[model samples]
Target: MSKEEQAMKGLWDMFKKRMWLDSFRMKESLMAYNPSEIHCIAYIGEDMDSNVTKLAESFDMTRGAISKLTKKLINKGLIESYQRADNKKEVYFKLTSQGKKIYNIHEDIHREFKDRDQPFFNQVTEEQLDVILDFANKYNTHLDAEIMKLGIKMRSDNL
Candidate 1:
């Protein structure tokens, strides 16, 4: 393979492995909540004014799937749905106390994962880090353009 092709394969391999690790870590750490449910809690906690459509769009999920997850969260007392008094038409989601606890824990889990990988990151010099960041930015922009070409509304750049 050419150097460019080799780099592409390496990036793809790392991306898949990273995804697998994240999913495995989340599943192992939180037995009670599925990955989608856990991510929903985090997103709702981060964006206080999250609605079904926003969640669906952000997650690349269908509105019905988001609705089902929201219902489950509500049943578990992890989230509560509310609407502004003036705007009864649009529904929003917020974390309950239990949900907040879960969100906090999730944040900690992220920190822990970062910490776990800190040794490797610490070994990299600032110049090396800068190169990695630049490459990542360029790749992400490339992906965004590809997504635009495909007419896929979900852009990684937006996230």
Candidate 2:
């Protein structure tokens, strides 16, 4: 591979490793709820139209798996299922007060991580930050195409 390719691959690998390490630390701090559970809570809390299919697609998991997680969350008082008048056939989820609490905690964790990385970001010039954002958008577009090739539908709005 060319030097640029090698450097890009190395950076990607290191970024993924750093994410895993952060996830591990989060898992340690939030032992009451598993990572998957916290993720579901966050999703439901953020999305007003969160449903089983949406959650499954977002997480790249089976509907059954999403159902299990939702059930667990429901039982834990973190989320509640609701049926809209126009879409009574399809059930959606919303975070309860307890779920909101969990969501806030999860957000706080993310904020802490971002704050920890703030120094690196602060040192980057505006032009450099713009370049990074452009690269990220292009990379996301590429990955979205690859995912489509595999016949998988993931959320693109967030990207």
lDDT of 2 by residue, 40-136 (tens): 9989988999999999888878888899999999999889999999998999999999889879988988888889889988999999889878988
Cα lDDT of model 1 by residue, 69-142, tens digit: 89999999999999999889999999999999999989988997798789988999999989989999998999
Specify the highest-lDDT model's number. 1
**What TM-score quantifies how close candidate 2 is to the native fold?**
0.76
- TM-scores for candidates 1 onward, in order: 0.81, 0.76
The lDDT of model 2 is 0.88
Worst 10 residues of 1 by lDDT: 150-159
lDDT of model 1, residue 151: 79
Taking every candidate in turn, the Cα RMSD to the unseen true structure, in Å, is 3.2, 3.9
For each candidate, what is the lDDT? 0.90, 0.88
Which candidate number maximizes TM-score? 1
